[model samples]
Every structure is written in C-alpha cells, then in structure tokens.
Target: MQYAIPAPPPWWSRLLARMSPTEDMPTRGRHPRALVTPHHDEPRPTLAELYRARRLDMVRLALFLVDDLHTAEDVVQDAFAAVCRHHGTSLDGLQDPAAYLHTAVVNAARSVLRRRRTARGHTPPHAGYGPPVDEGLLLAEEHRQVLDALAQLTRRQREVLVLRYWSELTEAQIAKTLGLSRGTVKSTASRALDALEKKLKVVR
Candidate 1:
C-alpha cells in the first residue's frame, strides 16, 4: 500500500513556529539589531585629536629629556608635525602612533642637544662670557646639584635614565622606544644609576 505524505504548514505559520520567544527578546535594554559587527572602514581618530589628547604628556616627556620647556615644546610640535606629514590625518596607518611620537621626540631632543654642543664648542670662551652667579639663587640648591649632575651624563645615559625614572617606562618599553636591545637597556640603566649615585654622592 502507498503512504500519503502530510502537507507542510503555511509559510507564515512555519516562520512563526520556528521563532523562539527568547531569540526575539531585547537584551539589557538594547535592541537585537543594535548588536552589529563593526565595520573595518570605521573612521579612526584624526591627528588633531591625537595631538590634543597627548600633546601635554609628550611635551612633558620631551621637557625631562631636553631639560628646557621651550625646546620641549618645539620637540613635541615637530614630532606631531612629522606624523602629520607622514600619515596625514590617518593615524591608523601607524602600528602605534604614541610610540612613534615618543621615538620622534627623543630623536628631535637628541638633535637639539647635538646642536647645542656644537655651538658651545665653537664659541670663544671670552665671547659673551658672564660672571658666574650662585645657582642656588636661580634653582633650589638640591635642584641645581641634580641638574648639574644630569648635565654631566652622556646623551644616551641621560636619555635612558630620564625615560626609566621620570617617564617610568619598563626596560622592555625603553628598549623598544630607543631601538636598543633589552640587554643594552638593562646595562645602560644600571651604569646610568651608578654614575648618578656617584655624581650625587649618595651612599648605598
């Protein structure tokens, strides 16, 4: 004997039957459609926004590195401008814009220091020489001594120390920022601290 097949339910009925009450329910006061996959082309932050968000901190980092507020501002400005020149408003192009900017500031500060050194080397001792005044009047005694000691450090040593202590970057972070190996960072930091202690005459 042949068996008769049952007819399928109406399309509307089938659709309604397949719908679960929970599946259509809103979650945490949000519509189900609102949970959308983000698009890859979503606009990234502009350079202006990045500069606004990070300029002050960048300037401070430069200040500690270069030890001059005006030079620090110039360094930070040049860094941001360089980013803009290279990437325009598309910060997404950079793997890490903040890191890039940090490196740029460090490089720029090094250039400034190099130029200052060259200028000092060429100047005659008597040309525009002024009588020495008590540094304590200009800076607190402790501050003057600390600055004097810092000035005595090699550029790289000073940079490593400032980034390590003032900026409080980890050895790995400092290494990446300065394009040095972790071993180099550790050795440089140790030697720098030792030299600083000697300059300050701080007893262990």
Candidate 2:
C-alpha cells in the first residue's frame, strides 16, 4: 500500500514564507529620510524562525556528538530554548546566530555526556546494553570501526574529529566554535585522527 508523505511542520512553512523574496520597486518618489532611519520596530526573524530553519541539521549534529537520537533531539531543543530565553524576538541582533546555535548545541551535548558518565559510574557493571545490530548495519564495516574507535577517544578528541570530519568545518571555524586556539584545534584534530587510526588498527 502506498503511504502519503508527511507534510512539513507549520514552522517550516512559515520560515519558507518569510524567506521568499519580493520585487524591489523604484524608490524615486520616496523621501531620503525614510531610508536613513532604521526601522526599530521592524519584524525581525525570531528564535522560532531560526529553530525551524536549523532544527534538523542541529539535531543531526547533536546525534553525531551524543550517539542517541532522543538525546540529540533533547539537546537541540534545549539549545533553541536557551537561545529563546537569551534573545527572544531579537535574534537578528546577534552577529552570528548560526554560530551561536552550533555552540549552544555542542555545549548541551557535552552536558548530556557528562551526566551520562556520572550515571554510568554509579550503575552496576552489567547494566549497560550493546548497541543495536541495525545501527551497526547502517554503516560500512570500515565506517563502523571508525565510529567505534571515535567513541573510545577522549571527549575533546571526539568533538574535534566529529566537528572536523562529520560536520566538515574548517579548523578556524572549529577553533572559533569551540573557543580554542587555531594551533590547538590543528594539534587536537591531528592527535584525534592518530588515536582513531590506532584504535582501528589501521596502518595509516
């Protein structure tokens, strides 16, 4: 039986509508003063618009960081909520809203990892379950090995590798996002790749 595709969320439609371009008319008849004065009351994009625009990509990023879809969604939600609380309707005021959202999601994912670590420490040794076989099947064996090894690295190393390779961010962007020096980001990423290779028993 054929199934209908799910419609895009309401916020997604609104975001698309907001992004639609309008034709510019001749301003020859308008007063010059009107152009010089910034409209303080102009309707700017809000946290909701940003969220609708970026939520899926942000959640995917969090998933790479945290390795759990539910946790990733929670992380993204918390990130957006934090942005809302901080910026409200003035999201456009931020110099780089996308960068801010990326930083917020990373921070939230780190918090989730910290909490999971603490909980794991308190739990019985046999309480943990193995990852699902379907998840393993989703990637090629080499890719799976890489991810397994990636998970075994230090949190900083994993962050560096994931942000660099998975997110395809430049070293400078990673450094800015993670609040690290450019040299530090380069060294950390190199070390992370080395450690991952060692874990996967790769010659390179």
Winning candidate number (lDDT): 2
lDDT of 2 at 179: 93
- Cα lDDT for residue 89, candidate 1: 81
Off by over 4 Å in 1: 1-44, 126-141, 202-204
- Candidate 2's C-alpha runs over 4 A off are 1-45, 129-143, 202-204
Q: Please, what is the whole-model Cα lDDT of each candidate in the order they appear?
A: 0.63, 0.65
lDDT of 2 by residue, 135-163 (tens): 44333444445556767888887887667
Report each candidate's C-alpha RMSD, comma-separated, in the order given.
Answer: 23.5, 14.4
Q: Residue 201: error of model 2 in Å?
A: 2.9
Q: What shift in Å separates residue 4 of candidate 1 from its native position after superposition? A: 84
lDDT of 1 at 196: 68
